[model samples]
Target: MHELWFGAFLTPTAENAHTLMRQAALAEDVGLDIIGVQDHPYQPSFLDTWTLLSVLAARTQHIRFFPDVASVPLRPPAVLARAAASLDILSGGRVELGVGSGAFWDGVAAMGGPRRTPAQAVAALAEGIEVMRALWTPGGPVAFDGEHYRLDGAAPGPFPPHRIGVWVGAYKRRMLELTGRTADGWVPSSAYAAPEELAAMSAVVDRAAADAGRDPALIRRVYNVSGRFSRLAGPGFLDGPPSLWADQLAELVHLYGMSVFVMAPTEERDLKIFAEEVAPEVRAALGREQRQAAEPGTSPSATLDESSRPRLPKRDLAELSPAQRERGMHLVRVHDGLREELAEIRKGLEQVAAGRGEVAALRSLINRLTMRQNYWTLGSFCASYCRVVTTHHTIEDERMFPALRAAQASLAPVIDRLEEEHEVIAGLLTGLDAALVAMVEDPDGIDGVRDALDALAGALLSHLEYEEQELVEPLARLDLDV
Candidate 1:
């Protein structure tokens, strides 16, 4: 399976231009792989998707940008191909194109673009892809005549810095078939298609790819998802805590071969949590699964050691006392606060990286703070965050674990493992602190600091996910005072 990728899907509204910019910057700083903006040219309040993406590309570095799914009716294939290539070149090859057969026919006609039936739209999109690819091909004076798109002696030049992938936003059978046949990737939203429906849709795409003599794996799967961050587990999908989100997304990768998850979060806190807590946990869990699958003669069941794994309490929420449920909610809230702090630390590291010129410079003319000042600020922030995490872990070790063990003898082994993991994380945090100090002494040590942070983040996030999965139900069932 491909390495899992995570991104943010931000709304492109003219009314919140500053907010959008800040979110894009934060998405990059938090180590997200991509940033996708929705395309709806007819919406008066929304910014033009391409224009907004161009601005974002100039403002941020290292994060890929895309129009979540451009409306092909309004965006002619010829012009769209050039725009994508130009932006990809300008952004140093950090661009992917997500195009869709046109929707909202009335809006397309209002914009003086073609309005076509569903069949016509799909046909037109296939031709559009051919036209774009021809234009992108090197040493090409393309000559093509199609019912939807025609080109004669159109000299193809100004190729992209990289092979820009054309991801199709497809759902229906015809569109999915076109995606499998012509597109580089498949883009779908969970809101429009439920989890249960995904397997059927993927089967359609897979069959089409096979029919087209294409390796299905070569076509990427990118999902646009939306969910809530809550204390207690909810009935619906992704309506719970960070661990729930991680588990669900990881399952998608393992089962359906969906490798990229782009969260559409309206709240900034959700974006932070998704990037810092959820994304890391998903990566770690998937890594373990992948490694286990690679080992010869090892049964998947044996890999997890189910005998020692913590089980959810038998009682449901309705069976738990009100006070116990409240305590459980409190624990989740505490974790949420820690997640936010972790996100801040990650963002601080990104700022430090930017200040040291480890990342490409922003295309801005405004004056900014000195590199030294930025470094010092980041060091201070890291120190504070480290202290908070350490203190939180100490409290859990001294009070919560002991109380839980006393209340439920069966939880002893789980508590012991949690405590042991705490010690390991503490050591990692100390290593991070040392690295930060070294960076302070020598500015060039930013790379060392980043390496240390990556290690710490990986270990800490995995620990957090495991702790939550094992403790949330038990905490809700027992009324132990911390």
Candidate 2:
């Protein structure tokens, strides 16, 4: 499967044309893959979809441009094909065609387009696909005779610079089948199709692809998602923090095979959050899952191997005294805090990377504000995190380790190993601290800080995992203070 792709779906309204263009530029700047504008040519307030896309293509350098779902009624497939190909050539293959059968009968008719039944619409779309493919092919003249469209002696030229994907915006069974059989991708909106409905819809496409002797995986699944971001989370889907969006989108990729997420944001900040926060985390989560799936004897919840080490005497939780249980709870709570802090430290590092870019034009202003605000803020947060980790380890070594060893003789070796690992982590923390200090002295030392933090993260995370695996149950069983 392809790695996840992210795009922005912006409204192509005349009133917000400038704002939309700015958002498109920002999307490219922030590393979004594509920019899609909704097509509603009949709507007086909306800009012509193709024209808007062409303009966006000219303005942005790298981002792909497409209509969210071009109305085939307003856009004849033969002409649409030529327009898409021309744009693709001009933009150096930065165009994807997202076409729909048709919608809004009254509006389409008002635009001097044919209004047909559902069956006729599907048939017309199928014929349109045929006509468009013929127009894109390198041939002398194309001749297509269908009930909906016909092209006799139509000259084909100006091929797309790349194999442009024909992603169909599909929801119905016939459209889904057509998408599986002909289209290169499937685009669906979360508003129209809920997450719970995706599995069944995907199954329809999969079966159709299989019946047509095509690999279902070859069909790229793209979802047009819209949601809210808030400091406070709600019960509804995607109405929470970026982390929740990441988790939900990752599940869609892993379970439903929806690899491309085209976010339809109402606010500008949501776009940045989607690109900077949700996208990367979803990629990371999917990467981890893929790696684990590829590895033999690996499970999602696999714990550290402790067979070689001495085993502590087993004692049921019921057998534990209330005081011992309370100690175990304390240990668990402290470990949770450490884990959360480690995550925050990593997030801070990400912020540093995101902000590390050329500021030559505003070098003076950036130096003044960044050094006084952004740099110090991150530095303080990281320093506090490091201190917390160090304190937790110190308490473990001076208090918990001795107590556990004295109570249970078999745990002595484990205590010794943990203590040794703690020393290693302490050294890593010192290195990280030095790196942060260097960053304070020289602003360009962010790279060095990143490297130091990475090293620390690897060692610290591994040590924490091993410690938790070896200590949690034993701590609960033994009469020792955490």
Please provide TM-scores, in order, for all candidate models, with all chains considered together: 0.62, 0.62
Q: How accurate is candidate 2 locally (lDDT)?
A: 0.77
Per-residue error for 476 in candidate 2, Å, reads 69
Model 2 agreement with the true structure over 1-482: per-residue lDDT tens digits? 34357999999889998899889989988878888888988899999998888898888776788889889878999999999988976675578899998878999999899989989999999899888888877769988889989998999855654457788999999999998888879999999998999999999998887677565665789999988998878887788999999998999987878878999888888889999999988877865764453222222222112223333434433355645544554555676577557656666665665666645575877654675467778889988888888888888888988888888778888888778777767776777777777777777777777656655654565566456546755776665545
Global lDDT of each candidate: 0.78, 0.77
In the predicted model 2, the residue pairs found to clash are none
lDDT of 1 by residue, 68-150 (tens): 89998888898899999889767755789999998889988998988899999999999999999999886658998999998
lDDT minimum window of 10 residues, candidate 2: 295-304
Which regions of candidate 1 are displaced past 4 Å? 296-482
